[model samples]
Target: MSKISVTELNKISREIRQDILDMVYTAQSGHIGGSFSSTEIVTALYFSEMRHLDPADPKRADRDRFVLSKGHACPVWYASLCKLGYFEKYHLSSLRKINSILQGHPDMKSTPGIDCTTGSLGHGCAAATGMALEGLMAKDGRRVYSILGDGELNEGVVWETAMAAAKFKLDNLVFFVDKNNLQMDGTSDQIMPLFSIEDKFASFGWNVLTIDGHNMDQILESLKVARNTKGKPTCIVAETVKGKGVSFMEDVRNWHGKAPSKEEFESAMAELTA
Candidate 1:
């Protein structure tokens, strides 16, 4: 597969950010901040870095896998998938509606390209770990990637699964922690105090890398480093702003799960388009 230029990927990410705003604004009930925080990572993976994707055949063997551990941010994931041809653009407006495959969280059975159902935080990481183990055992070259929220690390299960991944030496597994520092209700420190996210993952026996999550260049390079690593799982600690592209919402806790009002939506759209 030919690599998408950095400029193109950046442009695609901007479009995905707009789609995210549109989805949450239309649904009137999606996690916008988290979705925005996740846009670039998803765009980079699907549009540029990943391998063996057949949008027409999402279940194709040998394809790389992505699990949205921070599953509330499915708006961004769905947007990227739609833009990537996994589904139609028209479905973008149906997010969070009853019976819509584009639910508030990703549904593997309902959504064409989703690898696993997620929403209950922490479990997506575990599921990705299992997939990585399966790939390693089968000796397949396929790689598995997962995106997690910093707030979700408060769950003890994440560490348990982290230990299991390292013990099994699942080198094909790479996880990105969207360390935006804020979660619903308050900041990570105010809520759970995620002491040194990089140290925690490193202590768990994984190769750890930290970078500005919003920087496309750093993200692309970090992903390359993760791919080259061996004998253990890798974790990229992505320091990101919660509401990345929009002016008013950046690092704002209220946007964690709030749908914007009409005025706010227009303001957001203005900035996204500008």
Candidate 2:
């Protein structure tokens, strides 16, 4: 209820994680691992780093913008938006349900507070780059942010978008790379090894920062640095475990998009609540 402190953010993170577990378990489908991995980043943005995210003015022009490039992890974004009052909390229960506005991926037209409808891996980058271009061209002070999964980085379009963001000196853009080593398949190294996620972005001429994605202080600090940066885009490559909070699920690739069974769900809830 007060200005959110780190303690409050941690508590909110746990609540959001529990909600994600419940949402995925009830729907019988949804990406919980990635959602859990992104918990602190999303919280730091909505509660601490981002500006003009007042849920009441969901579409305010010049407001800070965000896109979840890794759209399969919509559960975390949805939970944050709900907590921020962008939507009804009860809507969380419908995630991945047939005909639910809460679909398998984020839909800007369907969801409040979603800047871009990103389902395909690399498309979100293009969209976020476009939004940053729009803000820069208009000289609007608003900033644009997006999160890309490390696994999603395998797409060539991501590099293309990165180059475009740098070309225009779109310093208004900030990207958070959720560098969780495991994807829907097995380890990212086993599936598609990406050589130095930070180097790849730096090669594009964007400012780069790497941090432990789960660390509350580091996430907030990187966001502050990103906001102050100018002349090019900023990318925060965050190393995170796939399933961060639950003991059994941490870094487990199988949980990428699989709903937990009743027992696993209960166990996850207990850990998160604890």
Candidate 3:
């Protein structure tokens, strides 16, 4: 796919935010804060950075893979996939419904564009690392990408995967930490202080970059840098607002997994549309 201009990318991100709000409000239950937070990151990858992905051939072997390690934020992933024509747009309203392909968390078996079934927090990063390792062994030249919540960093398994990825020098892997600084409970600092995500990743022997997660240019540029770095996995620490683009929701912990009421939904849609 040809690269989309930053302006166009920003427009897509807004539309995605709208979709997230609509999906969660319609479902009356879904994660909105983290989904909104990671909107631009996921948008940039699906629209500009990833290679060998053909919506027509969702299972193409050479396609770059993306794992949403912070699976509650699957609304962002689902919105992007629907926009890219992975499945019918009608499924957006079916989010979290019984047997819906667009589940609360990702379900690879039912979703066309999902590369992995995730929702177990730190497990998805480990899965992405394994996929990167597999690609290296097979010499398929495929890259694996994943996004993890800063809150999820509390998982010891994430550190385990970090060590393993560095030990094997999995340069084909790139991970983004959605450092929104808020978890389901409270602020990251209040819940579990991760003093420096960048320093932590660097200490784990991975190449690390920190950027404004919501900035389209920084997001695209960081992905480029990740592609060029050699001999180690790359981690991009993206600083972002938890409930981005919505005034009432921004940085508000209650919005983490709560659906907007009709009034709240209207307010959010108006903000996003504006």
Off by over 4 Å in 1: none
Per-model TM-score versus the true fold: 0.98, 0.97, 0.99
Candidate 3's TM-score: 0.99
lDDT of 2 by residue, 180-256 (tens): 89987688898899989888899999999999999999988897788788798999999999999999999889989
Question: In candidate 1, how many Å is residue 265 off?
Answer: 1.1
- Relative to the unseen true structure, what is the C-alpha lDDT of residue 180 in candidate 1, on a scale of 0 to 100? 91
lDDT of 2: 0.90
**Candidate 3 — which residues are off by over 4 angstroms?**
none
- Between which residue pairs do clashes occur in model 2? none
> How many pairs of residues collide in each model?
0, 0, 0
Candidate 1 at residue 159, lDDT? 97
RMSD of each: 0.8, 1.4, 0.7
TM-score of 2: 0.97
Q: How many residue-pair clashes does candidate 3 contain?
A: 0
Residues 168-240, model 1: lDDT tens digits = 9999999999999998878899999878888988998999999989899999999899889989999999889
TM-score for candidate 1, please give it: 0.98
